[model samples]
Target: MRERQPCVYILASGRHGTLYIGVTSDLLARLVQHREGLLKGFTSRYGVIRLAWFEMADTMAAAITREKQLKKWNRDWKCRLIERCNPEWDDLAISLGLPPLRTIEGTR
Candidate 1:
């Protein structure tokens, strides 16, 4: 099997509401889970499952460290980072080459 890549992702409630930062080996799958409200957690509770930003890492450990660091950054810093690459707040799941899901859009 191919090696698993770790990714750090941020989900937002909307344009500017709750923000959730997470690290996972399967970023697409995890994002789907969050969007479907299949997981009972921060994203579901706060409706923060809109993909906002992401960064790939060589390993899960590195991704975890980066996720922690980003979580600690102030709001402005996080916004700037997201806007640097995803100014329109578009979903990163599709951009990452995954099949589009309806959870991201009603008619996908």
Candidate 2:
């Protein structure tokens, strides 16, 4: 079995688009759920399926704290944060071996 690694992540609808911040113990599984539209809520409703940014935490508590902090951040600050690591705002899930997400017309 794989050891659990907590992570704080940000999802986006597109570059400079709607953003959602969350924390998960299994990043890959969570990303897959979001990508497949299985987890119903803000992300599914807004089409925020692209993995824009992420950070690993020492523990689930730490990841949750960081997620709260990011959630409170303003849009500009959040965008800058994502840009620092992913300038193009590309779907980071692809880097994790998941297939590239299909682009929906007008979502960008």
Best by lDDT: 2
True-vs-predicted CA distance for residue 40, candidate 1, Å = 0.5
* Per-residue lDDT of 26 in model 2: 92
TM-score of each: 0.83, 0.92
Residue 30 error, candidate 2, Å? 0.2
Segments of candidate 1 deviating more than 4 angstroms: 1-3, 97-108
Query: Residue 105 of candidate 2: its Cα lDDT?
Result: 73
Q: For residues 6-60, could you state the per-residue lDDT of candidate 2 as single tens digits?
A: 9999999899988999999999999999988999999999989999999999989
What would you estimate as the lDDT of candidate 1? 0.80
Q: How much is 64 displaced in model 1, in angstroms?
A: 0.6
What are the clash counts of all predictions, listed in order?
A: 0, 0
- Candidate 2, residue 24: Cα displacement in angstroms equals 0.2
